[model samples]
Target: FSYCAKDLGLVLLAEIDEAEIFKPIAQLKNQIIVISIIISSIFVGIAFYVSRTISRPITKLRNAVDRISKGDYNYKVDIKSSDEIGHLGHQFDEMRKSVLETNRNLNMLVKERTKELTDMTNALDATAIVMVTNRDGRITKINQKFIEISKFTEKELIGKNPCIVKSGYHRTEFFEKMWKTISHGEIFEGEIKNKAKDGTYYWVKTTIVPFLDENRQPKQYIAIQNDITDLKNIEYALQEALKRDKESAEIIKRHVEELKRTNIELRRKDKLKDEFLSMTSHELKTPLTPIIGWCGALKTPRILGDLAPQQRAAVETIESNAVKLEKMISDMLDAQKLDLNEMKFTIGEVQVDLLFNKIKKDFEPLLKEKDIQFIIRAETADIRLESDEARILQVISALLYNSIDFVPKTGGRIEVTAESRDNNIIFCIKDNGPGIPKDKQEFLFKKFYQVDTSLTRKHGGTGLGLAISKGIVTRLGGTIWVETEEGKGSNFYFSLPRKY
Candidate 1:
């Protein structure tokens, strides 16, 4: 500093102002401090933004984990960013879907297996003489059929040895063979003769199975048996029948001619009965026609309009009875025709709705008298069908008439419907009446089968309506059946092909 000062100035006294000297230095220092503060602020803002973006998805993932850990496989994270967090969420959803699918599959498998087990159990319970025993051959479980056939009480059979029913016929070796086969996890099948508690003999075709555990050692035994006593009796009878065949040969030869004569007589009698029925039907219908026509004419306003109600009631009663008699005669005639295979039909296209309307009109008065609610429902508008309109309409009318006899005295409901199916038209007649019993339902369409036959029976019908209807339906390439339960109601259904 002394050499440089000597060169720069003659008197290097260092004359300087303290205020101006540090001015630029102080400005630079302030600028550096301001720059540092700005940089720090920018970094702080970036850190806050990064934390917000990163922590939000992490927080959501944590919540999802909590829910999933609580067995909520349906919970999902909503991370949509194109980052590792989004990938994790996607993987998590896939895992959850797999878990749910597994759960559903397991549940379905359980249901299916349980249903199969139940069905198998029910089948075994019904058809077989089922019995279960432990490895020691003590009776553990037995079905009602077993108890019934053995004539042993449940108390006597439980924990009892199966030898209680041992018949002396089978040798001890036979049973030893059976035990040997079954104990070794093999099946033993044979004819078994067991003594009942009453000391009577019964035969059974038996199959004994040894139920094995995972180690392949028998844990228990299951015995299924079928009562073959009848078969055995039949076999014994057949043996006796063979021995008697020679003796019966001469007797059979002697009776053959007589049987032939009897058969011819029977045939002649049947023919005569049919002829008489035809003639009787014709005779009855001829006279009844005039009675019905005249009574109907009298019922009109122009004929007997001024008659008192009670007087008119008598006339109407005669008319109704005559009509029913006519129906019975017609039914007899139809049955005769069917027996002779002469029931003919003029098949043609017919309007079903028109037929229904006509039937409704025919039964309208009777229905109104009975106070029955009658409805005809045509699901297919202006329903046209290719069939014998006359016969089909007769069936409808007969069903309606039959329902009239069965429906309640008042407020009974009868609904008739025709629905057009893909290939056929279904006709249904539903009646709110005392339904047919289950035992009688099978015979409903049989000839001369009536549900009520007591002297005080309120319903009146020839019992030929359903039988004739069934025949007509069969001829028309259709089927008919009734759905009913006692104390409920009856639904009669008939299906006819669209082209018939």
Candidate 2:
């Protein structure tokens, strides 16, 4: 019984020890299960918290970002946590605020720019002349200037055809060309004359531009015009005046030509008169020459007896009258020949010394009668010059006669000088007579033009000697001129070219 009881006690003790070990192990397992359950619950709570905090805010941010991508700048995220997830939410919230602010500023800038553009457009519309038209060739919009000029109000012009103010001044061709140009979307500029509402004509320089639509078709035409009626009127008046002035000038020219014809006829009549006088003088001289020759024969000792003093005086008078009559005939003939250009010249070389000697001898008698001294000074004794000898002699004779007539009987003198200058022989005849007047010098060599007509009558000349001399000198390829001052002596010069 003791052994059995001891065995039962050992078994009990082993069972109790096993129970203790199993209980502790089971308690450890239970504690482990409880701890795992608490940890899993905590993890689930953390996951829920993270999901609510991070995932929810992130999702909200993603939605806001999506909205922003679709141009919705008004989206926002609500993330107000304080952990790491909260921090992420805070960052997303800050990003949303920054994006929203940027969007707000951008919108404000766009609004400002849009407002500015709107103001500019409104200002341009108000200040500039704007006209719009529909595609139907009708007046739609007109500016203030157009309304003022057209004598039509905006209400009167709108919806009205442009032909309402056409004025009917332009022809159909004008409108045809205008239509053709504008229909092709071209711009045309021209001046147009139109009748105003008051029935008065006016002008406008106009420019028409065609507006095109998207299909490249002409949609409307805009015409801008300014008034130029006054300028047109002024130009028209000027053109008319110019036409009248041109007509008057033509008439005056015709009258002047008629007067010139009449003057030419008068000159012909004068020439006929000169020719008649010359013929008459010659006719009278033919008979007088014979009479004078018979008188000379009567004075000869072999033919006439001694005469008394009174007879001698009468014969002398007849002789003197005959000489005067012969001089008048010669002067008339010379004047006629000079006027008709019928006088001929015999050109030849004449020694200067011989010419001077002949002139001195010929004038010696006249010089002695006037009690005046005549001088000849030659630079070269053998100087020979080409000239019409007889004509030159006649010129010299006439000059001597003029000097004798003009010079004072007591103190005046005449000088003849010849010299070689510039391949020509120059001869000068100077006299201490009263010089010609300034106004008369230009006409000194003109036909029938004399310094003193009374002097011409008293001195007995045809008033053509100097003119003939000038013609002769010009024909000989030489020149003749005179230099004189009032109250100073006159020097007459002539030059003849030297032979090579």
Candidate 3:
């Protein structure tokens, strides 16, 4: 029984030992589960903390990059970490600053360029020149002055060739030369006559320059010009005026030479005229002396008593011819004296009626011989005037004699009338004779001008009667002229100042 009890106790002790060992294993397992739960919780907390720190800043940085890409430089990433993310933030800020600064400078540069272009345009406008042409010689740009000068707008000139402004004044070769010069990257300066849009012509001093491209080829052209129409016109007018002045000067010089030649010829003719007058006077007087002497001697009874009828007729003819010759001599002397300006006048008050009666009686015998009817009409009786008595009588006698000589033999009549008008006494002699021709009237009072050259020979008298009468009347402060129409009679009138 002791051995059996001892076996039980050993078995119980082994079971207890096993239970104890199993209990410790169970506790160890429980402890292991708790430790795993704690470690998992700690690891989860650390993961959440790391994810929040990294993800939040990374998300902010991502948003900043998005804003920057969209040209928004104002956005910045806030990363407080002391790692690469902070360095990246700094770099991002710096990049944003640089981009902003670059943008600002670009905007400023654009503004400055815009202002410079505006200033250049304004300067071109003031200068009245601005033009741009394309590669094909078409106009592309035109300024305000170009519009004003051409009478065209920018739209009109654009796409139009420069030939559209041609005035046709220049040859085609001229434009060809200009094109050749400008197309070779050369500048051309010349005057061009161009037509405006209104079809009027204008002169322009032009400078054409070629616009070159990167390859040095002519891509476009610019033409600057100024209107010189008025200046050119003034120069042309001056040249024309100078040419006319030169022509006029040549003509005047020729006329001056001609006048000098004419004066020389006139001087020689004047000398010849004086010599002819002296010779004519001497020849006329030489015949008058002997005839007058014989007529006076034959009138004496002691030389010849009771002449026969035929002899008496001869003596009367001789006496009458001698008297006519004596009168002609007196007229020639008077003409010479008047021509030399040596004729003297006796100014005094004269009885005009008495003078007229004496002249009428003196011409009565000649009128009787010619069978001419004479009538005297007076406006007033004894109208005295201030004049030379003998000179006045001489003028009246000469005029009466001319009237009798020209009076037609078939129907001859003379009428003498006197009147006082204004401050003058006018005496008129009207004769029924062949009237003077229109063209012959101006020379009627000229010395040696005979209306009827045949009448001078038939009447046996010099043609100096009316000439001497004109001179005497002129000296007496009077004027004489004839009024007549063709186929009508002549009226010779004289006016003497009454108060002279």
Candidate 4:
């Protein structure tokens, strides 16, 4: 190795252990690698510990949130780190419980609402006459009430046109108006007359509701109805009754007018008959006055000439008949004047005693010839009356003559009496005679009215003496009446107002 100074390098190379010399450096390099590896191991261990502390809990929270977000509320955020993450997990769990409670309440509310809707539908089906129609106006559903009224089965009515129940009462324009309203998604309410399956007619109050689509146009229709046929029938009956009443009223008005016209005609005829009777009686009385005067003059012997016995007897008979005829004519004229209200009266005071004496003297001879006793009675002497004296005497004379004709020829009795009573002087002519029948007494004062036709002819009276006497008494403000019973004595009474 130290070989010769071949060079200093050769001698230095003979002293060099290159392996031993590089040993410390190699040791140092190894030492540095080991330290570097140890420090890296420590850092990795710390990193792993930090990730377990922070990232593991964060990952668990994220997974729990993910499950909760997926609607898996049963999953729990179970971070038990005693850090902020555990508190956050507790709050999240509370919020989940609140959300679950809210959901459950909402479900219960939905169930309750659904049940209420079902009950309402059932009630509507039972009570209402309900019908539903599709957009094509075909029947889709109907209730029992609808089936009963329409008299149709469910199978027959389903999918049938609503016009199947038409009564032909509504015109086309009516349905047109209804369709127009519903087509615009409106509600139509109205009364409809419809016919049943059995041809019976009915009325209904209907409401149509249109269901609209998203575009706001009607997609379908539903109808509900109730019966009103009875009301309509009653209205028709009332209209007919009112018409009949109006006709009856018109007929009654016509009959009343006819009756009024007939009554006016009868009044006119009665006035004409009264005028004719008055005119005829006056004409007959004028001619009778002269004949009665001539008969009286012919009976007097001195006025004409001395006559034989038979001639005198003939003249007397003629005078008597003429006097009776003249008296009858005078009575007829007086009766006619009373009917016309044309009789004249002279008012004065009449003395009762003096009037009675005159009547007694006038009828004395006739009373003797008939064998009748004529008696005059004065109940109150000095009796006075406010009346026509001549009319009073005429009334008394007619009654006396009537009695004289009817009295029994052999044993007849007559009395003429005058009396004063309250506010009147009453003159009564009573006689025992064959009295007038009660049924005929009322007609005795009427002109030409006699009790018996046979008795009037036998007595030779015109049957007018009583009529004239009543008319004269009435004109002097007095009343005349007779009280008689068949086969009994009769009393003729007349009263005039007493004037003080």
Candidate 5:
């Protein structure tokens, strides 16, 4: 606010008390409060009137609109006030009733007209194999076509399992997967081989679709099958005839091919020989362990306490050879199981530091004997992972053994390191050894393969250690590979997902 004073020219202005000018309003404070309260009450009354006359009826009509959109013509607004909105509500209810009546008659007409088409489809069911099996795999219904194909009477099939027609052609896992898929309301389509009542197998291109209930769970399975036995037989006959025609043309070249084929057969036989040796080693070690154990007991200080120097030495020799045999037998079994994918994993969380410490102790004697430098670097304190601990140990030990065999005898260096890689742990074993050549690296993981096959090869092995290591690593959801040049050190790296 600006103020102007009409004093003597530029003379000092006087102070003024403005409270007196507003004294009337201050004295009428109660009256002002009363007027404010009356204004608020009036506004409240109008808002209440608008809500009942406008918002309420509109809300009911909006709900009715929603019901109509969802195909529920039976919904109506029940507003009964004597106002324009109430009149509109009554008119809306009349329209809804009219539409509901019309819709009911229309739906009845549709079903009646389509009944003939549905019957025609039912009549055609006799031409195709239609069988219904409940979720439990029990036959619930089988049409004439199904009975004709299976050679079973409707009475015999009504409550029996669908496995009555199984030909034993597929594995148990196949059926397990089929049930798992259909039980989740998915369709399973495949070429199925079935056995007839006469013990003859037939082929059918089959599709089983699940019928789902309101909860989306399969209530039953509808199996529609098309007989493909004749087609399959024709395909087999054509393949055989083509094979014969090719064989006739290759008669002159057969001798050269025979030589190559013979080499393959020889290699196959060599594989069998290794497997036999592995089996034989297992048998030999079973008895040898008991023999070695008894010999040791005889020379012990407490059990059979007394022994001559030569006797004690002989007993030690037996024990030493027994340990070697045991190691060989274990390697054989591991190789066999790994090659056939027969190894099972008992997965659990493994503390990396504890595992590495145990491995260090196991290899301490070997390191001292060879005068080799063994280093273990576990980078993190809380490093743990989910895996088969025994298999993981086996793979690491195999890598260490390979290093021990090939690394320089005087100044060999082997380093085992583990560190976290994002959500996984990377394990690496590096060795300063006679490095492998590029040509030999590719075949290093093949069963019974070796870089050197000569009798006097410096590094002695059955040539299955790395292959078994690779197999174990792969099965544990990890990849193993050796990085080496012709003269540099080799680094074997594998990674396992870390659970913690």
Candidate 6:
């Protein structure tokens, strides 16, 4: 180191230190090391900044993708950045929602389909005799109903041809037609007769439907059956009943013809009987008329010679009985006329008071003989009826005689009254006599009905007086009725139309 300055040697030959010569180089080296350390620290801070902004978000996205791959749609991809990663996270959440909804819909659709199939199967089992067969007509499946109705066990029926239950009633052509229809994939419906294991026959309304393959040919058949055994029997019974009814109708027609002939004969006989009665009554009345007249003449002193008391009494008795007989014949003729509707009425204005007076006068002698009290009460003073005057007198006389015969011999009271009633004139004959019983009162107006049937009874009547009176009053447009109680007296009333 001293020899470098040897040309100027004499002055620099003295001691130079090594440390002082290398001091600046050592300072430069220290400055270079400090700059390297500062650069390294800056690079480390940049790496940390990149990790906070990008690496953490990418890691979160990776974890989200992992969760989504495991079907964890509930986990939220909550990247809140306004960058592509945030958009990606939003799209992934939407996809997860869509997948969840699709899964739910799929589950619902599966349940619905399963339920429909189950219901269809159960309905087939419950209601019908179901049978499934292959194209070869061998039974593959049969419902419980088929087994129960056929009286065949499942073991015996399965894999067997449907001919096992065939009844001989159906011909071979019947089954051939059914199979031909089904083979062409058509449905065949008919009533089938089948024999059971118990040797009994049953009928079924059967429908055979073919399940077609892609080529439109039958691969299998499903035969649905409904038992119609009872219906067939009912149809047969109805046919038999109709046949019997036809026979009965012919018999009834013959009976009706016979009845018509009998009815005609009866009409002819009734007319003949009426004619005979009329002739007989007229012939009998002719003889009685003269007898009644002669008896009256004998009783009169002026017409015939005066007789002794005994002779007079006998004549009077004959006259009275002859009068009774005449009255009976007249009643019979009147009844016959009424029955034939041939009675004639001479219509005229009849004063009710005169009619009553005539009734009182005709019955006066009998009333006096019985010592009965007779009263004539005319509530209608000038009431006049347009009717046959002679017939009115006859009815009044009959009712008066009926009352007089029944009244007490000593203290009998008879009341004859003519009163104005609603739109009519009412004539009532009341008697204080033994009242008719409740049960016999209704029959008092019938022909030949006698209230007093005892043999020892004091009253004597032909039982036709009231009946004839009723007929005459009815002919004159009137109604007759009697009111009587067991202990009370009797009142007989007849009403005639006031205008008539």
> How accurate locally is residue 425 in candidate 2, as Cα lDDT from 0 to 100?
85
Candidate 2 per-residue lDDT, tens place, 213-240, comes to 9998988888767778799999999999
Question: Where does candidate 6 clash, by residue pair?
Answer: none
RMSD from true fold, candidate 3 = 25.5
Instruction: Give per-residue lDDT, candidate 3, residue 466.
Output: 91
Top candidate on TM-score is 6
| Span of ten consecutive residues with least summed lDDT in model 1 | 1-10
How does residue 137 of candidate 4 score in lDDT? Answer: 83
lDDT of residue 210 for candidate 3: 93
TM-score of each candidate? 0.51, 0.51, 0.48, 0.46, 0.45, 0.51
Model 4: per-residue Cα lDDT over 75-193, one tens digit each? 76777777777777778878878877887898899999999998998888877788888888888898889999999999999999888998999899999999999998999999999
Residue pairs clashing in model 1 are 386-500
Cα lDDT tens digits, model 3, 278-298, are 678778788778877887777
For model 3, give the 10-residue run with minimal summed lDDT: 7-16
Model 6 lDDT tens row, 104-201 = 89989999999999999899889989999999999999999999999999999989999899889988898899888889888999999999989899
Model 6 worst lDDT window (10 residues): 3-12
- Which pairs of residues clash in candidate 5, taking residues 3 or more apart in a chain or in different chains? none
- How many steric overlaps are in each model, in order? 1, 0, 0, 0, 0, 0
Model 5, CA-based lDDT = 0.86
Candidate 5 lDDT at 39 equals 93
TM-score of 2: 0.51
Give the TM-score (vs. native) of candidate 5: 0.45
Model 4 clash number: 0
